[model samples]
Target: MRRLLSAVAMLILLTSACGEDTLAAGTYDGPLAAEGRQGAAHRVVECDDAPTGGNNYPGEYDNGALSDEPEAALRTAFDEAQITGVHDGYVLVREDDDRALFTFTDAGRVRQALIVHDGEAFGKEGWYVESWARCDYAELPAAVAERAGVEIWFDADGPVSTRRVHSADGPEHCGWQHLTFLSLGETTYVRDADTEYAEWTDAPYDSEADLPPHAVDTGFHRDGDHLWRSPDGTRAYVGNREKVAVWPRTKDGFTCA
Candidate 1:
């Protein structure tokens, strides 16, 4: 009985250590916020879509390819780039002279990866999306329009739940941030704060930040496609061309848990 209990205790200890190793510090991709950037690794290739020669800073770039086995690519790239000490949620991959942060799922799949520009740290603004290549072990996956029982379409048109504002408030025509994506029945909408941040601030309604947090709940007109403050109000995307903004549910909606 004593030997059996010892064996069980050893198994439990191994499991706990494995779990701790897999999960990094933070909840989502924000791991480095607490742990800080690691060693002297740097990025070599730019992660942008447009092609550039070498070692340039402050230019527009495109997002990288979605991968099921992004962790594998990080390892292979590490041989040349030397990325080390990756937590399960996020990893910093460094080239000889450049660095990028790769955010992964708990399962170790790649969610998104971005290049941190020169002079910028891991968590700040200069992180441009990386250019991902399809590996033999995993192919770049498609952007899911629907997940967790919710349907989503971009640049879509038709009668979506909407409301409007007087010119004094906003563009005079904005959908209730939540209604921008046409949903049905009990399907709930969730926002990935890292990806869809404009939903939380008034910055989108007025890029100049001139408005005083005005509410648009009056005029009503629905003509074409639309863009509204993302459900949170972080940034503004294009929304309906109608008059009134009709909110189907409550505003101050839920952010992804």
Candidate 2:
């Protein structure tokens, strides 16, 4: 299933560029807008189970809730899982390119897991997003939960930049699906696959009425920088900042601090 999703995402990224001519010549200098979208709200229509409001889009995405508070929800899940032990450090599990989860555990047993996100893909219209999901150890895809158990610690304090690479027609095409976060003092920047391509504009495409009927206008939080890997490790995300450029993760672009 992972391979299939990756293949499909690559296909989308490759085919998405073919429709670029639909946009007017030159670059779209205007603020990203969902001008022609069909629905009054801004969100991912493909997520049919999502709630009614832009902020509530996650009504039930992939078994997640729009109203779920990351930290609080994780606590509930911990209780249900009957997890017990002293608090341990956090584990950053890369599910895919665009989504990831920060699982806080105790003695290698996952007690709580929160979704780490970039405010770009799954938030408000033209805004950045940082949301979380709470899942029991069993709820997590076996691979991710297992990886968490193995204890892979990501070096978050490394130089804030790294190289991201991709082929014109490969999983890297939808690179926006996988993201890593970096901090430069007060400001934060997220690096991912989408950064490398100009295939899609950061426009809030709420409806198919937009240039591409398939475009869904997502929202995000702007208070800080966010970087998330989609649960599948096939996509990437960063908070929506106007005109943010994507850089390729090639060579030794970044290292552990």
Candidate 3:
């Protein structure tokens, strides 16, 4: 599944060029305003199942609410994530080339001046959006928009700019029956065959022969949905296993870190 996801992501990245007259293969489908996308209301979208939102669109997205306090909240989240090196009186966190999160607070009130964001595509929009606008239902005020420093979003067409909306009822909302798969690229990795790990072993063995002079079978097992085989070819692992890998572009790429 990871390989498949990577393949799809690669295809999307390769096709998502900012050129003209292209059919657009990638779909960072955020809450389409035309379809009444209100995917910015945080703390309200009850993610009971935590499905991937990008499945609906090529790319997934989210937002944060900044009142008079943003810097403090950012510091908290950053510190909690164990990310240091916040010197310029601001904290910028980004994973992979596509995902970014940042916060620039006032002199000290980080929480009150916070502007939260999540799952944003790169190149199209850079970091930091502030707003003084408030939500009536959530008890936010208008000044929030004016105070906001950045806006991140995806659009099919029209005025291209990211804006925050009520995500509790937005298109990016993740739920059951909603398998948002990014049609990235066609996969080439091989799966396991019943007969043997043909991809790893030399085929053409007519008989299930036994050990040949110190040859011992180690067997196969699972390592988190991935299958593994020892270097000596004497033993093998199967079931839930993941091979060491990276995304080349996305953060946690290949999960090496």
Candidate 4:
């Protein structure tokens, strides 16, 4: 009995250690924010319909041979460009001599597809952001999609739910403002606008107590300088606010319509 208990304890310890290792291995410590010029807009289209080359999707001036390891080469390009917030969870979906396709979940839990083209046909080399969708994995070449599927994991500290409120009209739309609320675990982070926006602020808090209360009500209240939904999260009262934004909860997450 003693030997059996010891073996069971050892197995449990090994399982715990393996779980921690896997989590740590998948953690990404790179810049969580985008830098430099923004890439092409995300769109749903056939892989063959993806843009080839232009100012928006510039090609590198490389006269040498293409790198044998396309995945590593693409990682180098992504790091050099300081692209969007792709923090770990990378799966190589397809690869060949001239092109490689990868899928990764961004910090916002938005699945994105990336393609690295050798540019042999166009005499240049470059990487492109193929597609990004909120819930589903963006469309890909049928074969690649079959292999990649839609499996993705979010970091413990990554955004699990997102809610947004935007100003519909302003002084020539000049004073237009947007607020995004990202819920990550027990904490909620608020941003003034999307990460790509020029001016923005990021604030994180644990609970309503952390925010300065602007007003209080039985069901609705204003905390953290932003209006919040009721405890049930069904209704919100925005006094004198121009627009009321309500996002329905979906099986995957919050859907903003």
Candidate 5:
């Protein structure tokens, strides 16, 4: 499944360059890519089924009141399960009598979906995480999106606007190479991905000088991050306020030759 998802992501990355020009350019049909090294990071673990050491709150509450204060309810539920690191910036995506979906970006700029459901567990009625996952640039699954009542824009290739900096050297460990930087407003998402490893970093700069010393130039001239590119576009000298970083493009995903 991992290999298949990687292959699918590659195919999407290849064909998504067409954008809206192609028939299926703007659609995405796949489960939320499980994050983390274990590949089970997104699995939903019921709080009641597991031992919460008395963290699980077993009580009766008004459904309408709980729905009105979703965040508060979720906080109580998360506390019951000892779930931490989720707070603020909660956008209610979907809410029904049985369940509600909220989306938020953590401090690392990784988007996450939190599902709180109203059901009876251990003879108590409350809200708890049905499931949650790290959603970087991919769209939510069809069923999830449908419940959210929003149209998610999915490009087969990847993010619509991004600057890709190919590693000067070929695959390092586990065929990891390219660095894709996506800037959305004030937030910049730096993603490192390959056949095996995938990681994201939030590196937002206030100005050119604020950018890190080794920051790769994404060819956005207006942003003051300039790159002196070779005539063939294989080599580049990325300039910043203090120093310049150089990268020689690789060919065939392995060699600089």
Candidate 6:
């Protein structure tokens, strides 16, 4: 919990891995793809406005059924420096971290956690948006806002339905490449048994590959190598990490089995 990065940066991330065609064959335009499809994660967002989800916390499976399954849709994608460097001209800058922490238990469904900084004018970028659970925090798409290149404020549509995610810090569960969290719904996946990936071309690159299902699954959990549940296990994406990324129920989207 306090090792952050070492061993020669984990041997330069196992001699560098996570090759999705070197960050998904880049391309973006028009207001940075309209802030990569409506950018957000939080900006003084405070919602307890009272939706009051049913009090059946006991195996609470009535109607919502893992909250409109699809592995529990929640999405955001972008990488290649905020889609070709700050909307093509660079003016991007995200700031907000008053000690980032936005949990969900009163029916927010484990969402929004920040530590942002996606700058511009000349150059600036930094990230840390752990658990960006989204039900639709205002639009969101554009490759799920560049997979965490940085700059977000989506609240995931107020009161999250099933599962959602947003964590950053690749390399160390298998060095490099891993930042697409929307565990179950609206397409957000990457967990072929804790992703020991070394290949999967059509984007995301460096070299070596073999794990591609794209997005969607509804049940997964593993704990020793930290690959938490909630794609449809009811909230708990990527526990303590040893290998985490989900979407494995049996059937869903992202095209895997």
Please, what is the whole-model Cα lDDT of each candidate in the order they appear? 0.27, 0.28, 0.23, 0.31, 0.35, 0.26
TM-score of each: 0.22, 0.18, 0.16, 0.30, 0.27, 0.19
In the range 1-257, model 6's lDDT, one tens digit per residue, is 11122212221111113222212211112121112111333322233321211111112212211112111111111221111111111111221321122222112232222222222211322222222223232222333335434223224243232234333333344444443333343434343323333233112221222223332232332223233344244322343332333333322433332
User: How far in Å is the alpha carbon of 65 misplaced in model 2?
Assistant: 18
Model 4 lDDT tens row, 19-93: 222111122223211222322223211232222211123443242334334454445544554333332344454
Output the better candidate (3/4) by TM-score.
Answer: 4
Summarize candidate 5's per-residue lDDT along 21-83 as a digit string, tens digits.
Answer: 221211112232233321222332222111111111222223232322345555664545434
For candidate 6, what is the TM-score?
A: 0.19
Residue 198, model 1: Cα distance from true site in angstroms: 28
lDDT of candidate 1 over 1-257, digit per residue (tens): 01112212212112232243223311222222111132111122122222121122333222222222323334443344322222123334333233333432223433233333322323323322233321111111112112111222222232222111211111113423333332222322222222244554332222122222343312222234233433443333323433323222213543322
Worst 10 residues of 3 by lDDT: 247-256
Arrange candidates, best TM-score first: 4, 5, 1, 6, 2, 3
Model 1, position 144, has a per-residue lDDT of 16
Backbone-clash count (model 5): 3
Tens digits of lDDT, candidate 2, 1-257? 11212222212112132232211111112222222211111221112122212221332223232223223333443444323211223333333333333443332233333332222323532211123222333322234333333111122432111122111112234443244333322222334424343233222212112122222222222224333323323223433333222322222332223
- Model 5, C-alpha of 255: deviation from truth (Å): 11
RMSD of 1: 17.9
TM-score of model 2 relative to the true fold? 0.18
| Model 3 root-mean-square deviation | 22.0
Clashing pairs in 5: 12-156, 16-157, 55-80
Give candidate 6 regions above 4 Å deviation: 1-138, 141-144, 147-182, 185-190, 194-257
Which scores higher on lDDT, 3 or 5?
5
